[model samples]
Target: MYNRLTLATLASLPKTITRPRYAREALRPGILHIGVGNFHRAHQAVYLNDLFNAGKSHDWALIGAGIRPADRAMRQALEAQDWLTTVVELEPGANTAQVIGSMMGFVPVGEDARAIVNALDDPNLRIVSLTVTEGGYCIDPATGSFNPEHSDIVYDASHLDAPRGVFGALVAALRRRREWGLAPFTVMSCDNIPHNGSVTRDAVAGLAALVDPELAAFVHGSVAFPNSMVDRITPITTDRERTMLTERFGIEDKRPVFCEPFRQWVIEDNFPTGRPALEDVGVTFTPHVAAFELMKLRILNGGHAAIAYPAGLLGIHFVHDAIANPLVRGFLDKLETEEIIPQVPPVPGVDLHDYYRLIASRFANPDVGDTIPRLAQDGSNRQPKFILPVTRDRLESGADVTGLALETALWCRYCAGTTDEGEPFRLDDPNAARLTPAALAAKDDPAVFLNLRDTFGDLADAPQFCSRFGIALKSLWREGTRATLQRYLNDGF
Candidate 1:
């Protein structure tokens, strides 16, 4: 048996497993991160750990907060171990483990969110970061605007004093800061959405607008939402990972995170009330984070979207196994090289082709336990963000979107709730009820699936894209995924 991970047990950890070098007690809270998930731990928290180990940014430690019922479970898990995380790095040759100690505490998870709002009210908490996923922003896909009419937003508007959601809590805190004559903290977005900073501003300011236009103006004018691109293939931790932590690393941590060896963060330098010197530890602070953001969103994220449905439809479980399939890998290669990469503008000092190669290699890492279902989940939000933007660019440029159309068709086939092998799986999208029936109906007329104006928007009305999508969907229904992918590989169409 292994000792439970805590500050005391840090000294007991094996020499191979790295633990925090700095004094945990000396670390102070400067960031109130809303989400405490694996990606945040593996990416942002890891960066802070590095900065702290270098004996800097002691006051810039993180205080985790959340707005959902699920956050309570995470809090319980992490708090049990004294807010320690055993992050396992899965690589091709060897695996490594580290215990990160940057998070000082978590706000109590509750419906009223008074704890989180109160935490945000502190002036010392200068940066408010988020990894709440792309869908959590309460944005309408069709209009590309914040949906203030959303029930959560509507509820938060009336209950600003005891807001239930993240934005509501932020508005409450900002309102308090304004009245108290304190400077507003920066709102940083680490999620994978294009122009994420601007999107976050709209969500927070839009919600504030509902309460009072003046409050909205104050928030819009004062708060700085910095756009950022964060990359780390962190898979959901299952019992297998927990078992690995015990067997391989000799750490009995309840909330261990398993991720690929590669991690990156590119941030826009816009923090008004001071921030961590993340640039000292490999973080790229830039004025134009958009180019980097777009390149990653299209190539890395879009590539995940491209491979996920095909792997899911083939009944593949792990991401490595899916990419290991020659046909599946070939489909992604062709799609990115011909259609996807062509649409992405040049990112400074980075070759687009080289970046795609790196993405492919990362996906092919077998040890990370990244699941196809993880990538496959949230397609209703993902497709519009990852896949359709490329489709839109290609269509507008009068370029052939044959590979993208095939990718879309694969998503539809996967949504029909069955694999090519006739095994049924529940669609994991939030809009599953609407997507499933539409996908089922599309077997007769492909336009039925395209009519999800919320998803496809006016792209359904384009003849070029529509015809290609219809033909590909029909082919998937008849020839199956394998044959269809082979045909696309053979014919550049």
Candidate 2:
């Protein structure tokens, strides 16, 4: 009853699984991670937990910090559990759960940024990892460059003493380290951006150049931002997850993270200062991460975008439900095998067919419970990264972009805030107010929506793309998503 009902007094639960010997032992801070979200827990923290379980890298542990007030809630939850998390991976035949104890402490962004900066200044802290979402970087999606003129960044440039954003905090910390004659920590970006490491380098160096040219040069020479491709379908936690762990698994975890069994982290081998032997725990360190990154971005993520909009429009809730429908699944399969895969560059040892099949299986995993609305959030930021890159490449190569163009049309239609059943759907993006109106007005004129320079950029003007997109939009508006998808599938688009 104690183990099943209450988490606060579970003394025996810690010993049931392979506990890290240092579960209760405090270690020196060696990594200062920003944005300690679920993916971080299931991926990086899981790696660190494995390393700690092996009784290696005890001197190097994690201290998490966050920039938002929402982080305070996470900090409080983690502190209550002594910075521990339970990660459960659901597979076909087996479900496994383990407690992770890699994080030592957390620092909150507050009235004074000194504590966070001081933590980063620690010479022992060799890695400053970030999972701050794509929007957090303030990069212009279309241009893939930092918007120095962004209000927050502009504020950061003017007032160095009081920094607001993550970039601002990072710049302030690096400047302090430089002034103290300390070597810069490796900047590892675990985000889903293309050339994420290079993007980080440019954004950081670009911001630094605005404030101090000399400091920018110093960063350029010393710092290392390693690009990485991280994947795992770890959805937002729910009360059902908590109940399952307590009732079925008999582990009362406060902030448990549930993910699919599949996990992959391909990282660029470019750490200047040093890094953990993450390779020992299934992280592939390679020079050709770009191939893997491109494959994953275009196939897995792109397929996700292809499915999300239609799922949202069809009144589907979870990813598995959408994949269960023959119409949706068939459309996804045809799109990937015929249209998307041809444009993808061949990866060294990987079969693209196998990869797509694997992605399909993962998407069909009912346990993931990945919501359509969650995936549909921030389409403005997501489309340019996940969808349009492939569209742009296909158009440039004179390859078939009919499917890609249709995917974009579906995205625009999804943004209109009305489902197939004529029920009101809430748009979940900051740019939704602008995008929804434009999308609705462009119900007949697809060009009106495509001209969204903020999202599509000049790719909107590509003649072939515009023609296909216009036709798809017209079909969807006239016949609804089901008929449009059925038509495309049957007519062989």
Which candidate number has the best lDDT? Answer: 1
- Name the best candidate (by TM-score): 1
Give a tens-digit lDDT track for model 2, residues 191-258. Answer: 88888898889888888988999989988988898888999888989998998787757777778899
Evaluate model 2: give its lDDT.
0.84
Per-prediction count of colliding residue pairs?
Answer: 0, 0
TM-scores for all predictions: 0.99, 0.96
Error of 1 at 390 (Å): 0.7
Q: Note each model's CA RMSD in angstroms.
A: 0.9, 1.8
Scanning candidate 1 in windows of ten residues, the lowest lDDT window is 142-151
- In model 1, the runs with Cα more than 4 Å from the true position are none
Error of 2 at 98 (Å): 0.8
Candidate 1 per-residue lDDT, tens place, 140-230, comes to 8876788988888999999998998889989999999998999999999889988999999999999999999999999888899988888
